[model samples]
Target chain A: MAGAIRLAAGVVEGSRAALSRAITLVESSLPDDFARATELFVELTRQQARRPTAHALRVGITGPPGAGKSTFIEALGRQLLDGGKRLAVLAVDPSSATSGGSILGDKTRMHALACHPSAFVRPSPSSGALGGVALRTHDAALLCEAAGFDHVLFETVGVGQSEVEVANMVDMTVVLLPPGSGDGLQAIKRGLIEHADLIVVTKADGELRAPAAALAREYATAMSMLRRRWRGWRTPVLTCSSHSPADVRAVLGCVRDFHATALRSGRFEQNRSEQELRLLFSAVQGELAFRLRTDARINALIREQHRRIVGGEVAPRVAADCLSTLFVERMRGGQSAQ
Target chain B: MAGAIRLAAGVVEGSRAALSRAITLVESSLPDDFARATELFVELTRQQARRPTAHALRVGITGPPGAGKSTFIEALGRQLLDGGKRLAVLAVDPSSATSGGSILGDKTRMHALACHPSAFVRPSPSSGALGGVALRTHDAALLCEAAGFDHVLFETVGVGQSEVEVANMVDMTVVLLPPGSGDGLQAIKRGLIEHADLIVVTKADGELRAPAAALAREYATAMSMLRRRWRGWRTPVLTCSSHSPADVRAVLGCVRDFHATALRSGRFEQNRSEQELRLLFSAVQGELAFRLRTDARINALIREQHRRIVGGEVAPRVAADCLSTLFVERMRGGQSAQ
Candidate 1:
């Protein structure tokens, strides 16, 4: 408890080192770390409840692997700092195989920004359960806000479904596609159209500039046809070039506009509140899995039902009901201490 | 119990009327209907366990609004009947408003096949919870198989993400794209590549023939580049024209080949077992939500946790643990009768 309190004190004092350590602690998903993280978060939440910290503008940047998301982020990070905004970049790639490369490579790609005192870049948390990783990322973002970052940009690859969860956690989701109109086909595969607040036609450099413009126009037409998920704004498609760096500001401008409009329309708070609700339910799922996994009686029940399910002796849905009834019955038999 | 037995007996006797009624029973998702459905399924499972009934080859067909899925199914149904195969076409559209049009439109599009003695075309079950809808569709498929259908093909619109669930419930998933290569963008929006076991270029007739061929080639190349989730056979992109019923045989042949290779490699059984496991877990989630709604104390606990979550007094993950712990304690306090 004392250690957690000290960590919370360091975190609230705007120590990036403390914030980074807090994130690492929360990322482990171990029971002890989870307990400490909870204590720290509770203290953090209580402190903020009184002090009322300013929430940072959370912008989610997602694209395919080669869409130059990191380069664009580097350019955007520099722009934000130049505009006198403290920025934090958290990349949420939840794959262990690529985590090492992703973390190291991100630092290399954003070398100038990484060295900047105003900019903080943390790689993906160590991957475990997808839900757990998402929870940690959400906490890490809040920690960055508590540490007084003016803006937090979450960058991730959209091939996995993690981006959808990340979108719910952020104020705005920006999906970037490569230049050519043909390449925009990928924007569909990635399921970005529905979730993005802004879509960037990235790598609009050299000879790709004309094609990128055409692609943007094509996407704008496509966007018009689809019903918007949120009110007060329609997702816009724009072009950006890492080489120019100025285009970064254009995308950032759209981000600012979206933030302002969503806040004005009340969707910002509504969306954040809903994200918390979803997080609660998702955590419920995680907790259920944890209990079923760790409790011997629950594990036995699940195994028995699973066997019947696999043996074709009972329907999975029916077996699920049996398991549920048995679980309640077990709990009723006074085995709640564990 | 007697009513359930009667329904089970009739279903096992290959009576389409009984099968349809059993389906309706499962589709309601009402407590009485769910209880009856469970009883009927338990009887059926016990019987099948003793007699080892042959499972039908389940296939899923999904496409965008105008991909000609129903027409192709009509064409394919005739061919299957001509080959003396008993086929069941279960269309699982979960939206009620669209259900009215789909049920009516499909009867019109498939009038000939619907009236044929060996063919059965059931429209989507009445809409409800997506999980419930998915559960009922799966059970309906099993009933159709138990009713002696040699082939049971599930048909649904791909836009709803329902196809992903249907994919898990079936042996093969076919994603249909319209003729034009340009229209293939709809295929992109539908996210057909990753989950599709076969990509069909539908409506390859008249002016659409050349375009359909090109589209098929384009998709074949795209399919090759993307990682194949299923082993033993790579996904094949083929062209099919409703005008040319001969193409139906080619697709059926491909489906059979994929099935044969999968069974040979033991992935078929492995896949089916995994589906059962997934179904069991999904049912657990549904059951949890059901309990949370019905159990007052549990609901109260969840409500309190929700308030804490919304108030930002605790992180959602932490709140979830508190809810789980509270739920068990509530149940342990001799409240099981509810």
Candidate 2:
């Protein structure tokens, strides 16, 4: 507990190493580590309460593969750093769960930005379920804020539900699209377009400029038909070429403008509050699932029921009901036995 | 229990009304209804084991909105009915949870098929989480089989993870694309293409014919670059016009071929067994979540923690840990008190 408190204090004192260690502690699943991590969070929360300044602005950037998300983030991060903002880049790579290695937020991928003194880049958590990865990423973001990072950017692959997870944790969501990817209608149909606070068409330099503009126009038209996510704010579709400083600056400007508007409209605080509540519930769900999976009796019951289900002797739903009933009975039995 | 047994007997005897009622029972969340539903499934399982005949061929058809899914299903269903097959069409509409009504599986949308004596068409479940909806759909499909349906077709919107859910419940998955929608690259990027056992380019009539063929070729090329979902079975990309009987028949032929191949390779039974296990685990998770939500003490604790979390006195993760620990203690305490 003392070590955890010291670590928390170091994090609040803006030590990058301490922040990284704090994230590792929170991500640990061992019982002792989990307890210490909880203590660390409590201490961090105390320090946060004592000095409540404006929280760091969190932005989520997501795009389909080949959308140049890494290059774009590097460009954007450099610009943000030039403006004297301490930045942290975190990746939520759901694919890491399967591959056992993260494909996003590899420091080598964003060499200069990662090496910058004012920036922190952390790869996705390489193990556990997608939900676990998301929870760890959320903790890492909090650690970054405690370490005095004024801006946090979460980059996630846009192919699946991870983007939605990232969007829930961030103040703004920016979806990057490659030039000439096709009509925004498909993205809209996939429900990706609606989650975007800002849409950027990447690689809008040289011969790709025309197609990029066309894609942006398509998204703008599609977005106009949807209800605004934030009151009094319109989702902007812009073009960016990461190689160009001006394009990078324009995208950053849009992000800042969106953040300012969200803050002014009180939507920023409201979103944070709602997101925290969601986090609590999700954590509870995760814990329940963990308990269910780890209970020895439940596992034995599941194995026996699974055999019967596969053998065609019982319906899956029937087996499910049997297992759930057993679980509920066990819980009640636990209370009564005491 | 007696009523449930009688309903199960009716289902096995191919009574349509009894089958519908059984589905309703399984979909019900009321304690009494849930108990009866379990009894019904138990009886159904016994009868099923006694017969030990070849199970129904379950196929999943998913496509984005505006992809002519209903028209295609109706046309293909009519052809199957003409071939002396009993067909049941179920829609897994995740949207129904929010809209309080199902947009898919409306009898009017497939007027002739829904009115056919040998056909069964059911809309999506209108309440519950997506997991619950999926569980009910799984139960409904099993009920249809118990009632002697030779073919079960699940139609789901191809947006989000619902298609993945439907795919797990069926033997074959068919994805539909509209003509001139775009290159197959975006769909491939979204990871939708790999889930398909077959791809159909719909609206291949009149002026759309050329574009449909082009779209089919594009998907064919894209699919060629990836691995076969089933060994020795290359996913076919076909062009279909619901208005054309030949096109509809071609699509049906591909579905049957895929089903036949799957059965021959023993992949059909393997997939079903694996899906059953997944169903069992998901059901357990859902039950746990339900208990956590409905427990009055836990709810009160959550409310208190939520306030602190929103007030910035505690971090969300910290609150989550606190709630989860309390829940665990409550479970143990319940046992100890008894």
Among these predictions, the greatest DockQ belongs to 2
**Native interface contact recovery, all models:** 0.52, 0.68
Query: How well does candidate 2 reproduce the true complex, by DockQ?
Result: 0.33
Work out the TM-score per prediction.
0.64, 0.65
TM-score of chain B of each: 0.86, 0.84
Q: Model 2: runs farther than 4 Å from truth?
A: A25-36, A46-54, A66-68, A98-105, A127-131, A178-191, A202-222, A239-250, A297-338, B1-6, B12-16, B23-39, B42-279, B291-297, B332-338
Candidate 1 has a TM-score of: 0.64
* Clash count (model 1, backbone only): 0
Task: Considering the two chains of model 2, state its CAPRI-style docking category.
Answer: acceptable
Best by lDDT: 2
lDDT of candidate 2 over A1-338, digit per residue (tens): 78977998899988888988887777676767766777888888887788764579999998887799899999999999999999999877766666677666455577888799999988665565323665677778888988889999988888766677778888899999888655553553256666899999999999999999998898899889988886888899999999999999999999989988998989998998888777777888887677666766556668789999888888877888777655554443433332
TM-score of 2: 0.65
Worst 10 residues of 2 chain B by lDDT: B329-338
Off by over 4 Å in 1: A29-31, A47-51, A94-107, A160-163, A183-190, A204-206, A218-229, A243-246, A300-317, A325-338, B1-5, B12-16, B23-35, B42-282, B289-300, B328-338
Q: Native-vs-model 1 lDDT? A: 0.77
B220 in model 1: Cα distance from truth in Å? 27
